[model samples]
Target chain A: SQTIHQWPATLVQPVGSPLSLECTVEGTSNPNLYWYRQAAGRGLQLLFYSVGIGQISSEVPQNLSASRPQDRQFILSSKKLLLSDSGFYLCAWSPRQGVTDTQYFGPGTRLTVL
Target chain B: AQSVAQPEDQVNVAEGNPLTVKCTYSVSGNPYLFWYVQYPNRGLQFLLKYITGDNLVKGSYGFEAEFNKSQTSFHLKKPSALVSDSALYFCAVRDGRGTNAGKSTFGDGTTLTVKP
Candidate 1:
């Protein structure tokens, strides 16, 4: 079975500080990875998605960026964080590009930017 | 563009009673609908999805969803509610044309509370 792991289950960062969140998937190779943010436990806003290594497509334009350094390793980073960047960050992985594929999500990271 | 709507902001039901969480979607091509559940301070869990074939698709945790093409809706339903079912539910949709690999637009989410 495939499992997704995210680091720093909870994080507290000061404003303007750097941010880094890592997501790694085990038992799967060349999986599609995605980054999503949920605000106030409501709607989900897609941040970025990667189909392969070094390829990323961003949905929302903000201070956030994502990278796929390896086949199953994805990272979300920011040079400087904003107060609005505080939210629950979720990492998801799907088998392939087909829409029929169901996405599997990680435990998620809670970032509190003060 | 693809979008989904979960009309109800909240739903309340008693244990052992049937429950329904409504969902509707819009897309240029065929719609691929999905249901997910979220517990407090946790990540969303995949409940079920509607790709093709049966209009009534059964999913995890004894939940099912009916795909009504005419109505453009895929509402999640459960015959009996459990207190453990109380959580946040989300509906998502995307154009099944293979254009945007796994991109889906999610609904605002509905809070379901099942009382014993």
Candidate 2:
């Protein structure tokens, strides 16, 4: 079975610091990867998605960015963290070949900017 | 483009009672709808989806959703609510079979509280 992994699990950063969150999927190749942020534990804000390596589509223009350096590895980054950038970051993956497959999500990372 | 609406922000139900969380959507093409559940501080879990076929689709943890094309709704339902079922629920929709099929628009989400 396929599984998605994300780390540092939790992080605390001072304002204006650089940010990097990593995600990877095992047991699947060429999967569609996505990044989302949830604030106040409600609505999900889509950050970015990638269909393949070196291909990333950003949904919202913000302080954050995403890159898929490998087929099953996606990374979310920020040059300088903003107070508003603090939230729970979730990474998800879906079958690339499926027309409408449901996304499988990782444990997620909690980021707090102080 | 596709959109999803979850009208209620919160729902309160007693344990063992029937529960329902409402959802509606819009899409340019055929709609592929999905339901997800999230516990506190956790990632959303895929509950179920509707691509084609049965209007009433059963999902994980004894939950189900009714797909009504006429109503443009896909409300999540469970026959008997459990205290453990208390969590957040989300509805999502996407265009089927064409461009942007992989991308889905999500609702604001609903908080379900199953009290004992």
Model 1, span B1-116: residue lDDT tens: 78899999999999999999999999988888999999998889999999889999999999999999999999999999999999999999978765654788899999999999
Cα deviation of B59, candidate 1, in Å:
0.9
DockQ for the candidates, in order: 0.82, 0.81
Q: State model 2's lDDT.
A: 0.94
Report the lDDT tens digits of candidate 2 across residue range A1-114.
898999999999999999999999999999999999999788988899999999999999998999998999999999999999999999999999875899989999999999
lDDT score at residue B34, model 1, on the 0-100 scale = 92
TM-score of each: 0.98, 0.98
Q: Could you tell me which residue pairs clash in candidate 2? A: none
* Model 1 per-residue lDDT at B100: 56
lDDT against the true structure, per candidate, is 0.94, 0.94
Q: Which candidate has the highest DockQ of all? A: 1
